[model samples]
Target: MGTFVNNAWYVAAWGNEVRRELLPRTLLGQQILLYRKENGEAVALVDRCPHKLAPLSLGELKGDSVQCGYHGLTFDCSGTCIRVPGQRNIPTEAQVRAFPVMEKYNAIWVWMGDPEQADTTAIIDVPHYGDPGWGLVDGQYLHFKSNYLNITDNLVDPAHTSYVHKNTIGNAAGEEVGVKVEQSDSHVLAYRWINDAPQVPLVERMGKLAGNVDRWQYYYLHLPSISYVDFGCIPVGTEPTEANKDRGFRSFSFNFLTPETESTTHYFWLHLRNYHPDDPQASDDVARLMNQTFEEDATLLEFIQREQERTGVREYARIAIDNAPLRIRRQIERLQSKEQSAEAAAMDCEAETAIR
Candidate 1:
């Protein structure tokens, strides 16, 4: 019945953010200590030491293990207590919880659920990530005061772009354009197209379209918290095909949302653009404009969050655009249900085995 789902992978930090030193962070409301071993392999552990409940991050890293500053209890990367400093025999309880972590797409993902279920294949694919034709803007981060679910709501609803992101990625031209929704077991998509219109500010700057053009916005939310926006503008009547869209100005914007707490989220974003793939300046511009756009959402969402809390109402009105967001919330609840059922079954099985 909790809003947080621990059975999924969440971005703990960017790959570069983790070093050999102890870095303490909270993910899914759990205190976690992150670091790299001597071989540069990433490790994530419960930040608390079992002995005195001291934060291991306050301690020092000794070669490949963490030495508890309070009592000198040392834990290896597997969260197994290997040294007791004064005692020769280590008790079975002298251990911590080590989360399963995987490094991919320039980010570190931590799984906070059953370790046996932490399959790396569930990680979503970022197409055209390393392709020579796509410019890369990665290792970007932002902090949001609103809940992760609120951010996911904003991501699925593109109707707000007209007003919220008018200065960056949205415009008045698409205000009347209706959006379409399509969903699957793994994702929810909300998108629309603006035909034969002037390019928005982002397009005019990075796209260099001399005249009216047709543009498309395809926003995809891959459960539980990956937001991918495939947006681009092409010459009016440019066929709207995949290859032709590639020929024009297209960009893949990805937002990886990790819940720092129930009300705060860590936003890690990366961008791949088809234009000027080799230009450093292009990458910088993309980062600036994208950050500006998301900041607009962040500020607005915080206000919305405050209002929802104050009034004890998250929704005052609902319309057609609510379809995608509604679907996402339902799917999340289903996942939570499945997790509860699985845990209950496991407990029953253990009880039966003990009785036998």
Candidate 2:
């Protein structure tokens, strides 16, 4: 919530974004260079060259290594200096810091903390990814001029949809629906069901619903910043069970929030829907609609962030709808606290060992 939880894995770029060419990006306040090696493996390193602090992004890519544009110093994918033109001895500190990165679910994830603790298994799963019956819309990106926490708050709170996304995914019928909240060690879920109601605009256009339907919105914030909504609709009077819900029109919409700075965020999103799996037209329509909806949020959030900065106040009041947002804030604080405690303990151990 405060800047970022660096110990966690964050989406650095989409799989297609990183290539043999050098690409520069800022994540968690650190400038990083991302590229793909000859074998198609993604690599991330500190953008600065150790020799003169020149940005590695300004350099040329040689094979899998980056050559500084000014000088002839070269660094490999591991951030080790493998070549130093006109030099016989390479300085021990001539290397840059390399980050742990991997490609999964069509996204490239990077670890910005202690490299030893970068466990790839900790990445959140996209269940419907690569499944036969799901239509996938991925490689979408947006830049939000707001803190990642602010975006997270909006994501887990469903009440704003009725107002913020009226033209796209929201309507007045869901204005008063009550939300149920639940939390586990790693995630918080806030969900609500709107029964005997007309489908929202997008759903109405996409699905063949009759008169009224039982629609659900499950906003799940998976630790730190990843969010996905389990949203769908079923005909009215149908049993509200998992199997029936899956059989109905359903979608898994994901948002991977990566903090670029305290005041800005990188939003990477993808959507998977059960219906229209093979309809290219439907996929294009979904992309257009979802992009419009998110842009609506981005515009509002930028203004909200500017005002918050002016007043130095995040909020003036809290309501029942804040249950999920509040829970996520507390969870994030706990994670930060735990990380700090672990770091301090490790420092103490190192100090004690050095003294002995």
lDDT on C-alpha atoms for all candidate structures: 0.92, 0.92
For model 1 the local lDDT of residue 193 reads 93
Off by over 4 Å in 1: none
Q: Count of backbone clashes for each model?
A: 0, 0
Write down the worst ten-residue block by lDDT for model 1.
Answer: 1-10
Give the per-residue lDDT of model 2 (tens digit) for 120-181: 99998897799998999999999999999999999988889899998877889999898899
Total residue pair clashes for candidate 1: 0
Backbone clashes in model 1, listed as residue pairs: none
Judge candidate 2 at residue 95 and give its lDDT. Answer: 92
- Number of the top candidate by TM-score? 1
TM-score of 1: 0.98
